[model samples]
Target: MLQSDRAEAAEAAAVIETQCPFCSVQCKMTVTEGGKGIPGQRRAEYKVEGVPNAASEGRVCVKGMHAHQHAVHSQRLTHPFIRSNGELVPCSWDEAFAVARQHLQGISEQHGPDANAVYGGGSLTNETAYLLGKFARVALGTRYIDYNGRFCMSAAASAGSKTFGIDRGLTFRLADIPLARCIVLAGTNIAECQPTLLPYFNQAKENGAKIIVIDPRKTATAAMADMHLPIRPGTDTILADAMLKIIMDEGFIDETFIQARTNGYDELSVYLNSLDLSQAADICGLELEQIREAALAYGEADTGMVLTARGVEQQTDGHLAVRHFLNLVLATGKIGREGCGYGAITGQGNGQGGREHGQKADQLPGYRSIESEKDRAYVASVWGVEAATLPGKGVSAYEMMELIHQGVIKSLFVMGSNPIVSNPNAGLVEEGLNKLDFLMVADMFMSETARMADLVLPVTSYMENEGTLTNLEGRVLLREAGRQAPGEARHDWMILCSMADMLGKGHYFRFHEPEEIFNELRLASKGGIADYYGISYDRLRREKGVYWPCPSPEEAGVGLLFQQSFAHPDGKALFSIMEGDPWKGVSEEYPLILTNGRVLSHYLTGVQTRRSPSLLARELENFVEIHPITAQRYRIRDGEWVEAQSEHGCFTVRARIKDQIREDTLFVPMHWGGVQNVNHATRPDLDPFCKMPGFKTSAVRIRPLHQKVYRENDSYTER
Candidate 1:
């Protein structure tokens, strides 16, 4: 049980009570109370601990363990702040809201409604995201808003939409992974990103599943795989296409399922006629033998699933790549079956929930399209807003930033995103932020992007708020308020309501509690394709978190979807033809390719985990991971201070040599910021389909720094 009062704790104890809401593993904890454990208080468990719940399983990583400390860190914004003389100063909420109204209204008054852009993060609660979407379309009178999910799961969702006529993934649950006999993973790093699911992978291994890993990096998960294919970056679609060709040529496809359930087979067949195994193998940097081996292994397995992550979906050709991957699953009749399907592992904890609840610019709740008349009318009827007034689609995250830099977007209201630290092409986002006539940011901490804001509003941490969060597997769980909010910090939803009220659009946000907002979203979802018509707050609370498609009282909602028929108009899964392409940044001048990712110790941007004493004490500072050969070539020593510079920008940090990385590429964790922000030197190029910047690849040079290395004395060399 948590203490009733936070006031009695020491300064250090109060700092670690916040929750880390970034990834699918929502870690719950209590901060250490008061002073760094005095002699009398040494026995107290001041460190944040994981809640013993079904969702968390009484386990947590470094990021989740120290999440609470971030809320009270030095960078936390305690009050409403307004920019004065190019400096941010603490101000009253009234003053902040006044500035907001003035700037936003002025932008609309002068340049028209289209000039304002609203950007939300996937990290936001379902309630906050839902209201933000409403505000963008109704109050702001603009359709230009998209969350970071655009960069994370758009391609996968779009691929599912094309195949199923609906944009959801598994009808199956995360628990089903352990039951699989074959798990075909393409371009995803699930083992590192979603550590909680690792045991399931091991379970599959124990069940005699042949795990096939296709990726550029030989990750820990890949190393554990029965087979790992080190394909060239950006060439995933090619491999997928080759597998389809083999499946069709060998007659492994379910002809009955194809004829009875799908559309567009002739077009796909004609498209695949041109590519050969040798061509695909050559382009993808894999041998034909390896491809054939992987294909046969996957096809022969009793049960299988093709799981992907940001790696396959973060490239310019991401959509096409996913489409091809889905093609293989459809051709083999692997989908809609137990322990076999096409699934994308979401990075953020609530990304699935946020998107389902209508955080996207082009979508309404229940995965309904905003552009469709029926959907718009049905949702409008439920939301009690005029269907005609609800605007159409808007630009995505990368596009918005481009528009901002191009001067098409003059003002931006950012919620729960640290684009300055998280987005690729950090320089471009910085330029865009500096150019904004008015920038409003709502967050608990004054993050890198928030620092550039014209107005910053202090918001409550997850532990201080009440709402529901849906995990990657579509399990919606309640978030109970366990601690008191600091200073004037308030819930993010409340702040939006106050802003809406000031703007004379209070009706758009009539709810007083997040639960009320969720009820309205559910109402808006009625009669839609991704319908949760039978779902209510009551059902959710009663069952932990129910999966979507919960439209019947008897339906527990299948975890592995598409077991009977696909959501396609023809009720069948369709295949797409794809070809391989090399990484866009491959060049002679910048010989080595660089990639970015996260470690078990940190989450995105390091804004939260870095602030926690428990987690930070584990890692002193930011460092780059590189292959020993590459490091030696640059005259770099292990644990040596160095500067990594790219064409876009540069940063200095210590380098750690590890053989896990490929000699031709370098790996950097995405969690670092301040003096060692990785995005500073990252390029702005985005995947053509999803518009997600190529965070995995960059061209960079490394040189040893004469300065002292931070971890020179640490004994990381031994276990």
Candidate 2:
């Protein structure tokens, strides 16, 4: 039998504590339990106690305080369930395993393996991610497997690897930000998203450092900045070219460093000289004076750093924007330093781990390209498979959705992702999922997408499982199970392994323990950017969290990467010749430009956060923020309902008057589902290079709802 509720009280009263596993700050937290519940009931409630930590300083946000609520919510699925007569019903573990295996095998035999795809999320642990990747590549023989990281960090990773030969996984140490004289926060709302990093920004401010913000809207972070340039969307590359032109004309570049550490600078200089500030100002929709101030401020700072996030990376020009940012840093001699560098703030907690474990279509463990014979042979030998039989790169998320709708792909296994609510052109994505011959969804909750699944396998939540998470800071921390599974639900790793064994791939999935899987992953990661062969659970416990590249047993973990030299072949970061066109979708018929992002009260798609009363109380419906002038032009009043229509679909929401927004633009948080799904209106046109859709901007129209003298269908009586 499981331990009694008294155990929670005793454990909380103990001296030891753990950290919140959500974000990178890794705030230390002490656990406590509420007094006994109704006398006859055996349930106990857990509470969070503060611990002295760098980020929280013995404090936590509302999300951290209510994390336990997420674990034990009534909506949680506590039993193995299978679809029967178009409705999911609880079933035995053996029955669930048999149904999943039989369907997957039947689909693979009838249609090629390429007809099926798997999607993973960054929330899974390294051990779980390792097993998932192996199951897709080694067992199913399908290359059509990708993770949610492709939508978040792949562009940044691609640019970094192309320039530095290694990706920077939150390697910028907190101890160094205070030394920098200037900090450029571009396209990131760090103040609200990662509250833990605010201290470093505050420390930099105290040290007399200049702060510059580049974004389309004047966000909270921008409001406090010394200078904020509201550059037009999709025009970052043009601005980069203008900056390079000014740098070359004013002789501000580090010639010695360029000559000694870089290549292609001369060619880039010529390409940039072809473009000037006047033309760039027109293309970027920024005044000449504002552009000059931002460029000169950055060029003149004693030490400079550039920090970016999803706002910059989720667009169609994401890769070019990243490469351009690298160019600016390298030209200014900021690549290798204490407080000055280029960093991409990751979104998901384990985004770094997800990409590292071979969940990407074209990559293997250690980030070796699957198309390269040498890399393939190395990984094949490690996994005990023949290199020749390994499939090549596969379709991305957008492509997969389109193919599924076109009847080219017949089956899919979705793990921990809700693309129906999160993907662009979500209406089409939903249609594609509905049309699939077979659909399997494995998650803790019956999410919007899971409700349409042909099979739903109940999986354990974070609190009920023991695993590891790699945060935005590149620190890897261990997770201890805080609660037992409520019913028959199992960990995702165990479920995947069980299915693999039932499908006759038992040898490759023979691990009885998660640590054994981790050991194999460490072996596969040898001699790569992240070396973990010498790392063990005991060693991780000895330290708070270990950064990668601790390849040797005697070596301590790395805090700052590329301190002396870059990983690039030339020992310097490479810069792309940035060039781009202007925003092309807006028109007289569709005068307003629509932008999408997060609100502090809610998370992505609100699949879990919305269910919490505390979070839901803050916001239960969607609202669009429009400039006061624009709202007046549309004759819309605050708290009044409005129709927001795009080319693909339309959603109705309340209109809010805010002077912070640009006059000709609209700001809508993309967390709502059912009646107010924002992704329904987002276009699917992708960045040519990275394949990321242009979700940031689109043509939109807003109009006030027609008022009626009397309500048509009144459910409430007037008092």
Winning model by TM-score: 2
Q: Give the least accurate 10-residue stretch of model 2, judged by summed lDDT.
A: 8-17
- For 185-221, candidate 2 gives per-residue lDDT tens digits of 8778877666667777878889988888888788988
Candidate 1 residue 189 Cα shift, in angstroms, is: 2.7
**Candidate 1, residues 596-710: lDDT per residue as tens digits?**
7777767777777777777778776778888888887888898887877788888777898988766877777777776688888777877665566777678887778753344
User: In model 1, which regions exceed 4 Å deviation?
Assistant: 1-20, 27-44, 47-58, 72-75, 248-251, 552-555, 578-580, 643-646, 701-719
Q: TM-scores for all candidates?
A: 0.90, 0.93
Model 1, residue 670: distance off in Å is: 1.5
In order, how many clashes per candidate? 27, 0
